[model samples]
Target: MVLILSAFLSSINQVFYAKWVQDIDPFVYSFLSFSITLLFFLSLTVLKSIKVKKSNIKLNNKITGMNSIVVLNIITAIIFICFYYANKYIEPAIVSAIEIGIGPIIALVLSLIIQKSNILKFDIYVCLGILIGTLILVWASLSGKSGIASDASFTYKGLLATFTAGIGMVLATIYSKKLSQAGWSTYEILAHRFYMLVPVTIVFVLNKKASYILDVFQSNWNWIILFTFLGLIIPLYLIQVGIKYCNPLFVSVTLTLGPVFTFVFQLLDPRVKWSWISLSGIGCLCVFVIIKMFIQNVGLNKEKPKGEKLKHA
Candidate 1:
């Protein structure tokens, strides 16, 4: 249920994110987005510290997952960079489909190899199914048939960024679970994960013209808050909660539904033209994800659940 709700909210988030990027520089948007999250969690941390001081309780400064935290922050910054560039050049629906769709398969393979477990033949078929669908969607966007010219350089950058982010997204999630295993609270993980991103983005934001940044803030401050909570803050926390209780593969499968929802919501925007090719690609992607879920369900019935392993991993 947490995963499903997270997927649903994330689907809506892609549309808003795409729209915002079209209006402002992706670098600025990315900085503002992370700033909102950082500030939210920072407030929480400060309040918690105050409470602990009032009670004279000793704060536990001995961090157990510094390595995982460092890795998670790096991957997260990469994901945000890719996310902004990809959404700017590629259709948001396609970006969401490929990023959310192909990621789990790769993560599943890596997990199996790391555990030295057999790769199910069914897994191969499912991976191929999702890949084919994702490819079709990419072709639709890049074929000069989706009302956007198929400029190689223009489209290639977005595709490259999206794939990079997809891989990073999976690795980030895995490391996040590792942190949870190390006993970091969800809010702490969320708050501290931006250690690298905030400082670096602050540099970029400052490099821009002050008047332009001020104008952007004045014009879109309301949207900044709205999308910050609706898109990043809430869904991120939910995803972390889901990650804490579910395996990465299961979480990825559930998130595949995000692109399906994005396809529908994306069409409601006038900026995006209706493309039969795009719809077909997303449809195929969703069908494959369903089949993969069914296969996983059957396997789970015969043994201890994957979530149990992830919780302990």
Candidate 2:
């Protein structure tokens, strides 16, 4: 249930993120959003520190997964930038479908590799299914008849950006799980993640120009605040909680809903048009995602009885 809610909120936020980044500079938006979220978490951290005794303060300072956390934060920043840029160049629905749709498969593969486990036959089959679905989706998006575009160059760049974002997301999920195993609380992870992001974003904003920061504040502050809350703060916290509690593969599979939400939202926008081919591709993608999840669940259930027997013996 928590995983579902986290996925739903995260999916919903993608729509708002796409809309906001259409007008706002991606770097500026990233900076403002992270800064706002960081401030909120910083306040909480400060309050907690004040409430705790001096002797206990050392407990909070003992960071266990510093390397993994740093890598995760870097990947997260890259994902934010890539997502914003991809949404600018590509239809949000297509971008979400291709990028997020492939994440679970990536996470599964990475998990196996990191654990030094032999790839199961089932894993290969599932990977083939995901690859087929992704190829179909990409073909549909690139086909001129599908209404996405005939411009190969533009579509290629968008696809590349979205794919890069997907890789970043997969890595982030795996590392977040690692952090959880390494003894970081979800709040601590979330706070530290943004703390790492804030400085990098500041550098990005400064490199663009000091004026960009001013522009972020001067331009629709209301929308910025709203997007920060709905698109960044809330969804991020939920995702961290979900990652902490759920298997990374399961969490990634649940987040496959992001493309579905993107499609629905895009359907409401008059500017975007969908073709039958693209819709079919999206259907295939969703079907494969569910099938993969079912496979994983069955595999886990089978493993459970064996573990129970071992314990009994």
Candidate 3:
């Protein structure tokens, strides 16, 4: 239930974010969003720590933990930039569909390599299905049969950006999972991430004149505030909480709804038109996700019997 809500919120947030980035530079946009979010989380963290006094919120001073958080923030920053640019160049629906669809596969491979985790044979088959679906999607987009309103030439660049963004998201998820397993609270982890991001964003914002930043805020105060809340704060909080309660792969899979939501939003917009080939591609991706979910459930059921027998023995 938490995962579902998180996925839904995240999906909606992406649509709004795609719209918000149209007038703002990606760097400037990210800086403002993260700055506000950082302050919000910082205040929350302080209040929570004060209430508990000597809470379990210990600092993870280990080199491995520190490295993970640092790398996670860097990847997050990169993803923000890539996704904003991709959204600018591509149709939001196509970008969301392809990017979100590809994330789980990347996460699975990264989990295997970094954690030496076992993979089910059925999962391998499902991955193949997803790959085929993704290929169909790419072909439909490249053929200019997609419903998205973008130039064919620029679509390729958008696709590349979305692909990189997906991989970066996967990496961030893996690192966040590691931090959760190592006894960090979601708030602590998120706070640290945004805190680290602040310095980098500050540098980016500083490169632009102060008046330009102020003028942007002045012109788009409502949008900026809404963007900060919806795109940065709420979705990120949900993700942190969802990841704390669920495996990263499961969380990523749940977010497969994001593209569907994006498609729905596109349909509501009078500017977009759906094509049969693109619809077929979307259908294929949905089928792939359904199969992946089934395989994961069956695998979990099989594991339950072994655990039961071990407990009885």
All-Cα superposition RMSD per candidate: 3.8, 3.9, 3.7
lDDT of each: 0.78, 0.70, 0.72
In candidate 3, what are the lDDT values of residues 87-148, reduced to their tens digit? Answer: 77766767776777787788678767876666555555665666676677788778777776
lDDT per residue (tens digit) for residues 1-313 in model 2: 5655655665666666666666677778777778888888777767776786544444444465688877988888788777777777677777777777787678667767776544445555655676676777788767754434536787788889999998888888888888878766676677777656677667776767677678767777887788778777777788888888776666766676666667776666555677676677667767766776676556533223333431100
Give lDDT tens digits, candidate 1, residues 1-313.
7777878888788887776676698778777778889989989978876775432221232255787889988998888888778887777888888888888777777777875554555666777788888889888777855523446788888889999999998898888888877666688789889988877777777878978877887899998888889888999999999899887776777788788888888876677888788888888888978887776666543333565442211
- Please tell me which model should have the higher lDDT, number 1 or number 2: 1
Number of the top-ranking candidate, with TM-score as the measure = 1
The TM-score, computed over Cα atoms with residue i paired to residue i, of candidate 1 is 0.88
Scored against the true structure, residue 31 in model 2 reaches a CA lDDT of: 79
Question: Once superposed on the true structure, which residue ranges of model 1 sit more than 4 Å away at CA?
Answer: 49-62, 147-150, 294-313
Indicate the worst ten consecutive residues by lDDT in candidate 2: 304-313
Ranking by TM-score: 1, 3, 2
Candidate 3 versus the native: TM-score?
Answer: 0.85
Model 3 residue 259 lDDT score: 70
Candidates 2 and 3, the one with greater TM-score: 3
Clashing pairs in 1: none
Two-way lDDT contest, 1 vs 3, winner: 1
